[model samples]
Target chain A: MDKIENNKAWFLVLPVFVIVAISAIIPLMTVVNYAFQDIFSPQDRYWVGTEWFESVLADDDLHGALIRQFVFSFVILLIEIPLGIALALAMPARGWRASLALVLMALPLLIPWNVVGTIWQVFARADIGLGGWLVNALGIPYNYTSDPVAAWLTIVVMDVWHWTPLVVLLCYAGLRAIPDAYYQAAAIDGATPWKVFRHIELPKMRGVLLIAVLLRFMDSFMIYTEPFVVTGGGPGNATTFLSIHLTKIAIGQMDLGPAAAISIIYFLIILTLSFVFYNVMTRMGTGERA
Target chain B: MSLQLQGIARTVGGSIHLHPVDALLEPGLHVLLGPTGAGKTSLMRLMAGLDAPSAGRILQDGQDVTGVPVRQRSVAFVYQQFINYPSLSVFENIASPLRLKGQERGAIERRVREVASLLHIDHLLDRLPAELSGGQQQRTAIARALAKDARLLLLDEPLVNLDYKLREELRTELRALFERRGAVVIYSTTEPIEALTMGGSVLVMHEGRVLQAGPTAQVYHHPASEAVAEVFSDPPMNLVNVEVTGGTARFPQGLELPLTGHLGMLEDGAYRFGIRALHLALRPKPGLPFLPARVELADISGSETFVHVHAEGLDWVVQEEGVHEHGLGEPVTVYLDPTRLYAFGPDGRVRAAPARGRGG
Candidate 1:
């Protein structure tokens, strides 16, 4: 068979390249440029190669913030994934109740991140809000502004409240894609509910779960707004995550070179971790099928 | 074992899926023959205990099991779709039912291997369902169902999704397998030839009711009504309006046949005549009427040919034994033997059936 020869389609993609260069590539390249040079102004700069990188990599504050970021992301994933799955499983399968439940689950996700932070901020106040006042009434002496432990708990709970719905929605979509025949077959096999979840539901949800895990991991790693509004980097630097610390160095103290270096490093860290997470999940999914 | 359905019916969301079905199935193959959306699956699901009937009771060997769930019954079901555990290897998929029953490891292994070999899927044991072809995946599902050793097996058009050759091969193997098993096998299919080839008692269903149920050959030879005859045919039996008066039956195409054999028993009134596709012949006999027909379509399917023609304002299909070429709009003559004609009354009831012809 003689195939049609056409080369006109290649020129159609030029506009997309131009738009991406203007929107993303150019900004990213400027950051890369700043990371290599100590820029006081566009006209006054020194080619201080790797100096900012070395200093940013060795800073004690950077190291502390990095560890804190990792722990927060880890805890978020640990709490959110299973909780989302359980909630999705508990949701009604059909009718008006299912539609209402879906709407309720999506309510928290629709709120703006900063707005969510402010709502939690006021909602956790011991004097006026229900959450903290109820906790104080139980004699726990809860106050997010004064105690580092209370601040951490408040931030974690707020993030869970705002984001677990994404995971639930993803898993629920995956659950609904499965045909009813599998469940009937499992029932005929006399499989218990746990076994059905393990063998049928979990395996069928693997693709969506991978997306959920990676999205949650990357989003939580880069999380800044809600925690910043709620804790302002904590009672005494306890919640100063990498993004907040970078913002402090870049804007508050105005160290452009070091902050640029930290930004590049932060981008690289998220990219590398997301890559590793994706590969491991896909490999695990195929390993069973293989 | 015996499974009895007492007026079992199913209604979903104000629509009836099955209506008051009563059946007694013994430990043998029973083929449910019907077209799509004819309630074959709904009836089978009720029998499998997968769905609760809106009315009536089901008894297993005289024990009521109407309220029982599928897990409590000794029954296995295979859907038309090749549904296997996509994440499990063929061996584990087959072993699932056995393992669920808490059989010993040795017993599970032995039974899985035995059923896998029976289905000719033993070599694909280590491969997952995703890794196998559709036919092999369906065979693995069948193996899993067989490993359960259930007293009742329900296969709902299991081969309907396969290619033609694979369908033929699996049908042969499944019939052989069902022959030796003591389970009451209820297989549902829309193909009448498949039911006949399986050679079992058949339940002919139309709309939401079983129009007729009897031995396969008996139902094929003498369908209870025109509805049953249509459901039990492939290209559909050719029907033509007829008038019987003055002791002679007259066709609309100006062909006449003297009342003889089964036609003699019919009263003088309007009737419908039915002729199977294969009984319409291109070569004419001395006693049969030679009606002129115009070829509408000639479908040459491998060794057989189905010639669709228009005669007397009605279209009819003529099944030729070999590949015969006929061009569209070409005039041809078709002969219908009076002895092979079936007479139906005004209400579609089979009034008179022809005597059993050669290989009918």
Candidate 2:
């Protein structure tokens, strides 16, 4: 049989190309243009190559925020991944109860980000908030507004409350996709509960775990609205992550050139880290096949 | 060791999966012969402690283990669908049970190697299940089951998923491997040839009930009822309603045969006569009745040909020795061997079984 050549399918993707170019590429090129030069006005501009990039790289405040961002992402991942898996394991496997539990678990993820932040802000206030009042009632001196540690703890807990369900949903789907035969075989093999979790459940959930980790990492790294509403990056720059810091430089100070440079760097950092994460995880997943 | 199922029954959401069944299995290979939806897997699951019987108790060597969980039972099951730990190497897959039992590392390695080599998959031990072929994957599963060294090994049509050649190879290898083990192996298959090939004892099941259980040849030669005979035949035994009276049998469509041989002892009444498809030959033999049949469809499966024909106002499948072509509506004379006809009473019990024979 002779094969016929047809390239008409390429034409079908033309609309998507046009839409992406208009939506993403155009704005990104404008940012790249700003990164390499200083703009005074629409009429007056000076091209200062590498100056903004160098200064943005050397800034001490950006470095602190970067470190804080990394620590926050790492801490949340450590807590949420295990906690989500535990909750998923405890959930009912089937019935109306399972449906109800799923809806309840998804409620936190369904809340808007800034609303979550605002909700936590008022909910953590020592004067009127129930959580804050309970902590004070227990004789613990807690105030997120003044204390740096308390603010950091509040933001972390708030993020955990908002996002851990995403992990639970992902891991639950992964756990459900595994066939019942594997568990039966494991039972017949006399595997203990811990060993079953280690060898069967964990390995089977590798794909969704990867998705969960990447999603949590990317979302927590680029966290802006929640912290902006709750802590406003306050209390001695403790909760001021990369995004909040970048926002201060871009919008508050109105320095587009340096802001664009920081934006490009931030984008590259996430891209590079996500790529590394994807490669490591995929390699781990298929390591047995190799 | 002996595993006894005492009045075992299973009902799920008001649907009966298995009726009450009682049987004692000794340390040897026993074939569960039944078609799909025949509750072979249900019975095996109950016996392996995978599912608790809704009614009765299962005893292992005279001790009740009905409520005991599958994890606590010394049993292993190989499913029709090949199941192995996808993330684990074949070596680790086989070593898993041993490690779960907290055996020493050296012993685990040795036992894994022994079973892997026995299944002819030692060279592929380092490969994962996804990296292996279907036959190799099933071999790995069987190897893992072997490494467990359970007292009761239940194989639920393990070879049913493999190709014909691979199934043949694995079936022979498994029979030998099973013979050396002391495990009471219960191998279930829908194929009658497979049941006969793995000849030890055979339990014929239908509609979740054990119709007959006896030595493989005895059950094959003398099925307790028409249902067992039907379930035990590959192409399905051709049954013809007949009236036997005055030492003469009258079949439909004016067919008649003298009741000589073992069929001569049957009491005169309405009965069903059964002849296996293999016994219904195309060529005429001496001292046999030539029953005219119209070919409905002729199917040549592999080496043998199955010629479906309408004879005596009933559809019959004739198992020819080799490839034979017959057009639709073509008339063919089917030779009925009187010595091989089984006589079943109105209640479906075997009134007179054929004389013990060599083939079939």
Candidate 3:
């Protein structure tokens, strides 16, 4: 076992290690530098210490964006995970229907993220798109560009359409992995379809669902493209999410020191939660099957 | 009610259709034996009502059950894959049937424990299937089925994954258990000994067709054809690879085996012969024919000897339990009952056609 550790088999990972460190570490140092020191120009700088960090933390704009991010993550998890699972269930397990459903789902995910934003941007405009025209035709006085609730709903709907397929794909794989014998046993047990889903399908998918939840949470929290394109944080900052707000402060305001501080805190929030999710999922597997 | 399949056929994957089959079964422990791709599992599936027949109908107690859903079939199947809920504890797996019917908690617990005890998996009730050994998981799966209280039991090679010794012991116990309960069992297996030991009527299948169906003893003693004879033992009942010509069957290596007995299917001339190694008695038993031979080789099983013989210009093999005095190269005249000869025609069918009608 000791010799197994010393096998310098790490030679295989040496190149990967170097690449990751170069890409991740170098940018991280730059962020750290801007976080503590004021960079007014290319050649002039002064240390602002925690002044910018405190100001950014105290700003009501930051508070509002943070709340929106949290709510968006929560709402997406609520809607997408279950809806995706339902879609996965209704999908045929094999044959033409299965492949067709897979291809249809895959089409959405294959579109680039920015393209997704542009598509939704045009699709939700009342003067131009079918969806906007339908809502107006229904006379609900809906305007995603001008109304906060409409903007939030539009963003959530766009995210679901774009990402629910990922959850469906994962859950579909989990469902397929279950051996037919289990269903045979369930049939013998007199389980209705509902009981089988609750007692078997639900538990079997818990592990994958956790992963899906964490991924969707992270993606939804850091959402910057679609909402940004649709509203551009517009109608007086009603649709402004945290990442979009951060970009405005960091790039639009050109205040690197405060933006850097805000970004570090933002990174920490994601890092902490993602770590917790990963730790919990891995530990659960260890306590059970292994 | 006994499970019955009369002229049932099913096609798998839309392209592969099995031959139409008929099976009249009794309420006893029946073991369906065959080789790979023999449609044994498909037969069990039909019996369990998990599948519908494409050609003919199934009748249970004179009731057409061809369209009965699996849940209403009153038949329990223990699948070969041991597919219990991996996330549920052993007790939950066993109690699922009771729980599904809204059985009182106390009664569910008692029944689950009883079935668990019967299958010898009571101690592992708290553990999930993934936490148990292959054998233990298999027992939980069996226990779950037992607790279901179905009228007919269909086992699709349920113990195939078990170690050899455990399989033998469990099979023996299961046979007795099913018999004592008077529960009809339709079991499918790829092993001949399992069918014989279970001691039900045997249905020998080959390539989606039942080659022979009868009592275990009858099928073993007089298999309908070389194809049926192949299901009798492992590595199959070996053929001498000789052909009947004139009055004698000749082998390439300077041996002429006389046409010891006649079969109707052989066209007055050429054919092949087969015999189960176990059925070839070493010592003469009253009316049994003894073939003169030498011990060419011995399969040294710890408790039994399987002797290979070169006899009368033909090489044949026999199994002798608790082999006491057999030595390789020792000249021995092993017995073969003339009445027990299994002859096959050139077209690979039982040489003897049904003399009158079907014989029981």
Counted clashes in each candidate structure: 0, 0, 1
The TM-scores of all predictions, comma-separated, are: 0.95, 0.93, 0.85
Sorted by lDDT (best first), the order is 1, 2, 3
DockQ of each: 0.49, 0.45, 0.32
- Backbone clash pairs in model 1 (N, Cα, C under 3 Å; residues 3+ apart or in different chains), count: 0
Clashing pairs in model 2, backbone N/Cα/C closer than 3 A? none
Candidate 3 residue-wise lDDT, B132-214, digit = tens: 88888888877877887777887889889999988988998788778766567788898887888888788888888888888
State the lDDT of candidate 1 residue by residue for B1-360, as single tens digits. 999999999999999999999889999999999999999999999999999999999999999999998998999999999887777889999999988888999989988989999999989999878888989989999999999999999999999999999999999999999999999999999999999999989999999999999899999999989998888877899999989998798887787878888788889999989989988888766778768899999999889999999977578999989998898899999988788889999999999998875766
In the range A1-290, model 2's lDDT, one tens digit per residue, is 99888899889999999999999999999999899878887678889999999998899999999999999999999999999999889888899999999999999989999899989999999999988888989999999999999899999999999999999999899888878988899889988788778878888888888899999999999999999999999987989999999999999999899999999999999999999988888778445321
Give the per-residue Cα lDDT of candidate 2 at A174: 82
DockQ, candidate 3, comes to 0.32
Task: For model 2 chain A, give the 10-residue run with minimal summed lDDT.
Answer: A281-290
Answer with 1 or 2, whichever has the higher lDDT.
1
Q: TM-score of the B chain in model 3? A: 0.80
Ranking by TM-score: 1, 2, 3
In model 1, which regions exceed 4 Å deviation?
Answer: A1-10, A285-290, B282-287, B322-328
Q: Taking the tens digit of each residue's C-alpha lDDT, what string does model 2 give over B76-160? A: 9999988888788999999988888899999998899888899999999888788889999999999999999999999999999
| Positional deviation of residue B133's Cα in model 3 after best superposition, in angstroms | 1.6
Candidate 3: true contacts recovered, fraction? 0.55
User: Lowest-lDDT window of 10 residues in candidate 3 chain B?
Assistant: B351-360
* 1 versus 3: better TM-score goes to: 1
RMSD of 1: 2.2
lDDT by residue (A108-132, candidate 3, tens digit) is 9999988998998888888888888
